[model samples]
Target: MVILGIETSCDETSAAVIADGRVTANLIYTQQMHATYGGVIPELSSRAHLLKIAPLVRTSLSKAGIELKDVHVVAATAGPGLIGSLIVGYTFAQGLALSLGKPFIPVNHIEGHIYSGFLMNPAPEFPALILVVSGGHTLLLNVRSHTSYQILGTTADDAAGEAFDKVAKLMNLGYPGGPAIQKSAEKAVRKNISFPIADVKGDYNFSYSGLKTSVLRYIQKNFPDGVIAPEEQSEIAYGFQESAVGALIAKTELALRQGSYRSISVAGGVAANGRLRDRLADLSAKYQVPLVVPAFEFCTDNGAMIAARAKALIESGIPDYGIQEPFPSFKSVFADAPLVKRS
Candidate 1:
C-alpha cells in the first residue's frame, strides 16, 4: 500500500510517503519565523503551510520514487492543533485524494504520537505505558493492545514543552525551548538547585503551570539585578530541566507500579530532550523494563508518524473515511482516536 501523509498541526509543514508499511520518504519544513515572535503566530503558520505543503508533497513522492497517481491513500492530521494550520493540510490532502480517487483518512494528531512507537525497530510491548510530552499535550496512556488505550492522566494546565518554552523566553534563550534549554544545561554547575514539582492529588495527572511560575519567581529573586551571566543562565536552565523531568519520572514510576506494564514508551517533541532521555533510560534500567522511543526525526511534528498511523488504521479495518474536514477541537478529536478502539 502506498500512503501519502500530510501534517501541519503546529509550526511544521511535512509530507511523507509510506510504502508497504515502511516510511519511504519524509519531508518537513519548519517555521523559523516563529523564533522571532517567541511563539507560533497561528496566521503565519497557516500561510506558511499553504505555501510549503504542495512542494513538500511533490518532493516526498519524488523521493519515494512514486507519482501522485500511484498513491493508494491520503492522510492528514485533523487536529488538537491550531485550526487554521490544521485546515491547510487537511484540505490539501482532501483535494489530492479527490483528484487521485484515493481514500482520504483524517488522523488525530495526538494518536499519531501515540502510535509513533511502532515506526521504529524494537516495538513497545503490549500493555505498555505511554507518556506523550509535547508542546500542546502531556498525557499518560495505558495501551493494553495495538488498538486499546485508556487515557491514564493529562495535564491540568501548561504542558511540559510549554513550560520549557516559557522558561526559555524568560531567560532570553530562544523560541522552541527544548533544544535551547538542553544545550544551555550542558554547561550548568548547579546540579543541586531545586524547583518544586507539581503535586496533584490521587491521580497520575500532570501540572506544569505552577512549576513554570515558580521558576519565574526563583529567577526574579536570584537575578534581581537583571544582568544574568552565561554561566548563571546555564545553571538556571539545568535546575529547570531537572525539575521538569523529575516530575515526569515520578509520575511515570507511579504509572509503572500501578499498571505492571511490560514496557514504557515516550513520544512527542519533548521526547527528544537529552536530559529526559537519559533519565528515562535510568528508570528503564532500574525497573528492568524495556523502553521505547522514536528516533529524533519522529519525535516532533512530522508526516512519517501520520503515515505510520494511517497504515495502522487501514489494517485495523476501522478508518473513518467520512471525515470531510479538519476537526481541530481537542475533545472532539478523541472520537477519531487512531490507537483506541471505538465502542
Candidate 2:
C-alpha cells in the first residue's frame, strides 16, 4: 500500500510517503520567522503552510519514487492545532483524495504523536505508558494497543514545551525554546542546584505554570540587573531543565508503580531533549523495561508519523471517510471519532 500523509498542524508543513509499512520519504519545512516573535503567529503559520505544502508533497512523492496515481491512501492531520493551519493540509489531502478517488483519512494530531514511537526498532510493548510532551500538550497515556489509548494525565496549565519557550523568552533567548534551553543547560558547570517541581495533589496530572513562574521569580531576584552573564544563563537553564524533567519523571514513575505497563514510550518535540532521554533511560533501567522513543526526525511534527498511523489503521480495519473537515483543538480526543476525524 502507498499512503501519502500531510501535516500542517502548527509551524511545520510536512508531507510523507509510506510504502507498505516503511516510510519511503518524509519532507518537512519549518517556519523560522516565528523565532523573531518568540512564538508562532497562527495566521503567518497557515500562510507559510499554504506556500510550502504543495511543493513538499511533490518532493515527498518524488523522493519516494512514486506518482500520485500510485498512492492508495491520503491522510492529513485534522485537529488539535491551529484551525487555519489544520485546514490547509486537511483540505489539500481531501481534494487530492477526491481527485484520485482514493480514501481520505483524517487523523488526530496527538494520535499522530502517539504512533511516532512505532517508527522505531524493537517496537514498544503493548500496554505501554506513553508520555507525549510537545509545544502545546503534555499527556501521559496508557496505551493498551496500537488503536487503544487512555489518557492517564494531562497538563492543568502550560505544557512543558510551552514553559521552555516562555522561560527562554524570559531570558531573552530566541523562540523555539526547547533547543535553546537545552543548549545553554549543557554548558552549566554548577551541579546540584534545584528548582520547584509541581506536586499536583492527586492523580498523575502535570502543571508547569508554577514552575514557569518560579523561574521568572528566580531570575528577577538573582539577575536583577537585567544583564546575565553567559555562565549565569547556563546555571539557570540547567536548574530549570532539571526541575521540569524531574517532575515528568516523578509522574511517570508514579504511573509505572501503580500500573502493570510493560514499557515506556515518549513522543512529541520535547521528547527530543537529551536530558529527558537520559533520565528516561535511567528510569527504564530502574524498572527493567524498554523505553521506546522515536528517532529525532519523528520527534517533531511530521507527516511520516501520520502516514505510519494510517497504515496501522488500515491494517486494523479502519475505513476512510471520503471527505472531511478539520477541527482546531484535540481536547476531546477520547470522545472523538473511532478512527478518522478528530471531532
lDDT of 1: 0.88
Q: Give each model's whole-structure lDDT.
A: 0.88, 0.89
C-alpha root-mean-square deviation, each candidate? 1.7, 2.0
With candidate 2 superimposed using the best TM-score fit, by how many Å does residue 104's alpha carbon deviate from the native?
A: 0.4
- What is the TM-score (0 to 1) of candidate 1? 0.96
Can you give the lDDT of residue 122 in candidate 2?
Answer: 77
Q: For every model shown, what is its TM-score relative to the native structure?
A: 0.96, 0.96
Candidate 1 off by > 4 Å: 321-324, 335-343
RMSD of 2: 2.0
Task: Give me the displacement of residue 253 in model 2, in angstroms.
Answer: 0.6
lDDT by residue for model 2 (241-319), tens: 9999998999999998889888899999999999999999999999888999899999999999898878778887875
